[model samples]
Target: MASATVGVGWGWWGGAMRIPPFRTSLVVSGVLVAGLLLGGCGTGTAASEAGGGGETQGPCAASGGAVGAGAERDGVRVVGVVERAGAKESASPSGRVSERPGVSVTADSLPGVGAAGGPCAVQYDVTNPESEPFTYTITFSLVDEQGRAMSNVEETVASVGAGKTVRRTLEQAGHPAGGTLDAGRVRILDVERVPSDEAPAPAGSCPASGLRLTADQGDAAMGLRVVGLHLENCGDRAYSLEGYPVLQLLDAEHQPVDGIEVLRGTDGIPMAGGDDGPPRPVTLRPGERAVSGLAWRNTTEFGEAVTVPYVRVRAGAGADPVMVAPHLDLGTTGELGVRAWRKDETDPGAGEGGNGRPGAQGPYGGSSTS
Candidate 1:
């Protein structure tokens, strides 16, 4: 068999819908983030000690409870309530005061700083209203005092038990090239969760399925986009994969998106890298990963843009499906290309971030069509 360097068509996404509606995002200068930034951060909710007469004064300080607003559609909800980071809601710094957790969005976490070291940050209080433990991926967007959009961010919380609540601070990802951001508004955008045992990870405890599946933030320059879908054998057993990885795109509502095309190999959108050969059988051992891709171009003209927020992936037949949020914004291109499964050449070091493996990407020797 020849070592086919192969198909140039790169990626595909956004399922069918009757002429999707226009989608747009606003990214501005760091000035917005900085202006919205808080003075400092303490442990949880309001960061303050004792004040006059055993009182506590902080940004999240109790003033008839935190006040703000958010939107909830489908199963996703964005309500404002402060709790200790990664702690249960039963313990908010707003003086505890037993009460049912409210679903109203508020600005209690406003002007907050997160690990991102930038502005446009907010905290989330995740409550697992389910019966068993499950993992969650929550999406958030930065808004201004007037509730205009600024930036978006996402956080994945693994394994929350029934009736348990956890909190996390998520901030805008990076500085946009040019524009202006509204100060200090972050709200939940979406949330997609799955069973804890079925959640995918780059590296961690072995999954019940024997393999781990994860998605990498692919590159996007101009209108071209490329995202990597990876599968690694984490269990003791070897896993066999043949043909293309199955994919299902979902909207913010977690409903199936229709009409978008998923093409075999990358011929639809011509590109230099992520060449695809015919689907072939590949086996992965412990710590070994396989790489494929979802690529497309964001080209819109009159027609509404398609934005896919979630992708449910099955590495092989009968394999458990793991939901990943690559947030593909297919701008009316209508077609998406997927590369076939191939052996990844990236080295798995002492298990750093995500499965301990690295991506060489194009010409980096990270992937091979052998």
Candidate 2:
């Protein structure tokens, strides 16, 4: 496919809990991830970057694509223009048009890949400089020139090794806040890092306990919010569970959220599709999935409003604690309600309708691409 890409080094700030105080529209020239190589294109590297501040390579002599990329900050690089994805372009006189490479770009819209595309996405390089492995829960968003958030995507990068870096492509969910934003608006909203041992096991990975854990993006209506917590026996052994999962609300910095009480079940907060049924002894065989839920109200009545971005969960006593990001916008309610665990009976392959994520195995078991 034809391409239009550039490599440049730009830096930005990181924040906690919610969106950061400021945002950066970075143009990175680097890739640390290993993936399918383009059939006719050379692999990209920061060391091969061109443009200002370094030795440059003009657009690939034959194709206009920016052949290389550059530096990273806070262990991340937002490789400028990736897989242009065949979007029609009206070159802004300064765009590095893959179909006509050699042009330099300070800013331009990526028709189907950026704000022009219904789904906003970004490529991120996350590195763990610490000696031990760590997992990161990174929040990415699209914002307007006003700096107001248009849409947000939360993702988990599991087990980044000490001094090693990995890359991921994250996309926003639903129609999003602004529906669609303009170009150069992708920003890093927040980053929370935790020791791998303390982080939740990803859905496909089997931890020592032989189970995997994950939480949904959640839904809210009329100030009420509900998020599903999923657990599966990814290993060969059967796992047994009874009662509600233990919960801990955490701030962006990973500290316990104060003042919010953890209610035992959803009775305190009512909502549709909520399971108020009794907890039953459920044993999940290999490939079996169980689900629990969380409920809360974001009604602001007084004092200070609360927004928790993390939750530490354990299936039961003696089980490992898994960190889930249900992004509790608890308002000033000071309470979070939990639901008992029950075996999931939904067909694994069912789209679950609504805004489905691209491809199968997409996060949240989404059946379709959003």
Candidate 3:
């Protein structure tokens, strides 16, 4: 028996035992090496595909399909998306979409998050279209252009009377880490209805006793001074506040200033924690505070000077009014404006500041009104 030479070339089994010619062996080895390389590349491509072609990255690209407006699922319709800084986008529901009787949902404009720690507000108009009252848990997600959710899926439970609408604002903190919130693409995650009798009782109104009202005047800009009305819950129990604080300017004689008119409006000045709906109840525990904004213009176009030596503030219509001697001078236009109550950055629930009550400062953190 003749001993055969088993020559190795580049880890290939070749060059012996009546194997093919050297050229043929080289060609075979090359094909084998190329095949291995191709296989490795194929594996990488498969891995990429498994991970969504590597397109879904960051916080927004979570594990949910793109949910468009009016794309009903789980018994709810996203009626519309109101962008805080943009226009309203209407949702077009599919013909197959069927809403649960006495259940409807709508999303409202989200105010931009400010330094004082305000949430992107979603005003939901939950309606009971039927003749009977119902309670429901409405779940939704604020998504970005990449179908990524900017905030966690939010849910709010409410009771709606028959053929009536109950409006509430759900606050979502923080923006998408990577993409912009596609306000037009809000998704309704779920709507679960229950018997009205099982619904939780509505929160109670904030009484004047538990609340301490203070005012802080912001820096004057363009003849307009902004005043932040701070309401602190001084009592041990939680208190809820909704709507604007009743305000009036007082002259040096401690009398209501003549020729001054307070207008209720939402525009003309930017305010932190401002929301665009009717007063929504804000529950404040002991030491917690909420803020409402006020603006007064002093300088008239004719250069007339308007000055107020004091201000009177009432938490609500029936609350006893308090007089504040802010001595803030508005250029003599005798016109003022106010914003609805909203959670301030210093709110205990906001978690931006420590667990102490917020000082009486304007939205811009100016001097204390006291």
TM-scores, in order shown? 0.58, 0.58, 0.37
Instruction: Give candidate 1's TM-score.
Output: 0.58
lDDT tens digits by residue: candidate 3, 1-370 = 0011111111011111112111101112323323322321001111211122323222222222332333345334432222222111211221233357796543322223231012122334565666666666554655555776544343444446777654343334234433233234456655545445433222232443767665542445455566556676766898776777887776754467777677675454333233365667777778766777666655556666767766768778876665554456766555667777776544243312211213332342322111
For model 2, the stretches where C-alpha displacement exceeds 4 angstroms are 1-131, 137-156, 162-185, 189-192, 200-203, 272-277, 352-370
**Candidate 1 residue lDDT tens string, 1-370:** 0010101212122211111111234332334323323322221233221111232333223322323344443334433323223322211232322346674322222122232323222344566777888787665665544665555554566777787766444433332223222123445556667666656663455667777777755557778787877777778877778888888888865689998998877777856354655777888887787877788888898789999988888986678888877789899988878777887766654213322323444422236553
Go through the candidates in order and give the C-alpha RMSD of each one to the true structure: 14.0, 12.6, 29.4
lDDT by residue (193-274, candidate 2, tens digit) is 7778877654334687788776655555577777667777878888898988998888876789888888777777755233
Report the candidate with higher TM-score, 1 versus 3: 1
lDDT of each: 0.54, 0.54, 0.45
Candidate 3: segments with Cα more than 4 A from true spot: 1-208, 268-275, 345-370
In angstroms, the error of model 1 at 244 is 1.0
Model 3 whole-model lDDT (C-alpha atoms): 0.45
Residue 274 error for model 2, in Å? 6.8
| Cα distance off (Å), candidate 2, residue 94 | 29
- Cα error, residue 200 of model 2, in Å, equals 4.2
lDDT, residue 201, candidate 1: 60
Model 3 TM-score (2 dp): 0.37
